[model samples]
Target: MGRHETISRRQLVQVQDRFIAAWGQMGAAWGVSRTMAEVYALLYITAQPLNTDDVMDRLRISRGNASMSLRALAEWGLVSRAHKRGDRKEYFIAEQDVWALSRKVMRERLRREVLPLLATLHELRDATDNRTEQPAGAPLRLASDDEPAPADARKPVTAAEVRQLNDRIDSLLELVQTVDRLGERFVGSDGKGLRLAANMLSKII
Candidate 1:
């Protein structure tokens, strides 16, 4: 092998293992399977496309596991299926466009986490609106004039305090809405808006 044929030597195994494990952990935190993330990391770092057998061999995963991971990655738009002219076996490659990859990930995360969070916040804000009605979507009201707390059991909340709490919740809702809109622009703009915003923010900062 030439001096620059590949990475350094046997010692590099440690680095590769560490990177794969770290990537898997990160993916797990983001609601992805650990092995699937490790597989994607491997395909990302590898310049050439690899087949199921190759992935299984490299990752020490079973064939079923490798196929399932690859299929999931393709579904997520993070990996692409490939083919060779003379070979019949299916191969896979990772999406090299990091910006697109990041956008997809953020889009999914926002749908999974942020959207639900906003719903919950909206419900909370409505609850703070002093509406004591017990609807299906609305949160349960704590105290109301009709059903006041027992004397000396708990300190009665003042109207001023309620207004202050509503204001605070409103502030939070506004901030979250702003973030949701920005995220929509970033993910929906196909990288143009993201780059523009990042460049402008960098210059301003």
Candidate 2:
């Protein structure tokens, strides 16, 4: 019985190691650091909260790396800190609900990536409009009798080309705005909006 228990424990460790490695790779693919992903994976699989020292020892990482990773995870809402009575040390646990986890990740990405991109697109479109509104003629030159006058040499952008470019930019802007609106309607709030989104995704997937 002792040998069987030992073998089972070893197998469990190996399985957990595989999960940690795979989660790290997935995190890298999703633009998260490997260490942070591994730490989260470890916490996610565990039933109880773990302290910084436990994380460091289990992951074979330094104190600084473990601490920083934990902090980042906490900021992302993937992990939360726990306080045990009479224990001054902090322990961390992963958010276990799949829906909540997905919501947090999407919210962070939209804030960090999508909103900035939309702002940049707006700025670029405004600049393009301003450029297109400029007059197409060169300034009048004062001719001298001694020097032969030259023709206006500036080749300004044509109205048709500007209109075409503006249309394309407008189309792109509209597309982005549509996506932004959909995200807001679906994931921006809790309760009904989230349920609606989940239902829609269920049908589509």
TM-score of each: 0.71, 0.76
TM-score of 2: 0.76
The number of clashing residue pairs in model 2 is: 0
Per-residue lDDT of 38 in model 2: 96
Local distance difference test, each candidate: 0.85, 0.84
Q: Which ten-residue region of model 1 has the weakest summed lDDT?
A: 130-139
lDDT of 1: 0.85
Off by over 4 Å in 1: 1-22, 25-33, 83-90, 130-156
Candidate with top lDDT is 1
Can you list the residue pairs that collide in candidate 2?
none
User: Judged by TM-score, which candidate is best?
Assistant: 2
